[model samples]
Target: MKSLTLPAVLATALFALISPAIAQYADGQDATPEQAQAYQDAQGCILVLKAAGGDDNLQMAEQAMAKAKELAPINGDDTDEKFAKSMKDWEEILGLASVDESKQFLANCRETWSA
Candidate 1:
């Protein structure tokens, strides 16, 4: 019960942050190529993480997240407006579906990619 609560809480918070970004896309606004690619990767990772109950699925999610992170631009101080916005969107996805092994995978991705 406690374990389930954590993921639920995290997912709720993630959704809170994600709604606005999603609305932009929903309004038929176009995302840049980089943003589109990153969104696709993160969306794939999140779906796999949410449904995954095995190591194989977890691995696939991790790989997808890694690719998403790679496509996102890193900004020290997050001063680059577009890059910062893109990362915020990507991080929201990480928050939404990451749990247990998926959380560990996100941590690893951050560590490896941090500037």
Candidate 2:
């Protein structure tokens, strides 16, 4: 029998939570400026999470996310519709890779950002 994996499980849960806003983009609808910024910032956080390989990774990720929030400040509670939708969009774009792939991307992000 095939076993369920963590990423698969997470993806399934994400699909259930996210809105059809993902599909809206496929029809050539452009993201608003706020949406674009949120996606960009989330993508950066995803990289930081991947790069944080030491014991404090989760803390690092949380700090980075909080800082991003302070800087950009999206609306609504995380469980609320609007915020959840934005998270869904951000994850749809930035959450595709496996762990190894994310690590590779993290390395690249570090190089690009540090230069």
- Among the numbered candidates, top TM-score falls to 2
Candidate 2 lDDT by residue in tens digits, 1-115: 1111223433354343333334444555544334533434443554455456654555545654654454333322234465545555556645666776555545544443333
Q: How well is each residue in 55-108 modelled by candidate 1, as lDDT tens digits?
A: 755665666556555543321112456545655664565545545745654443
RMSD of 2: 9.7
Candidate 2 ranges with C-alpha deviation above 4 Å: 1-39, 42-54, 74-80, 98-101, 108-115
TM-score of 1: 0.33
lDDT of every predicted structure (CA atoms): 0.47, 0.45
Model 2: which ten-residue window has the lowest total lDDT?
1-10
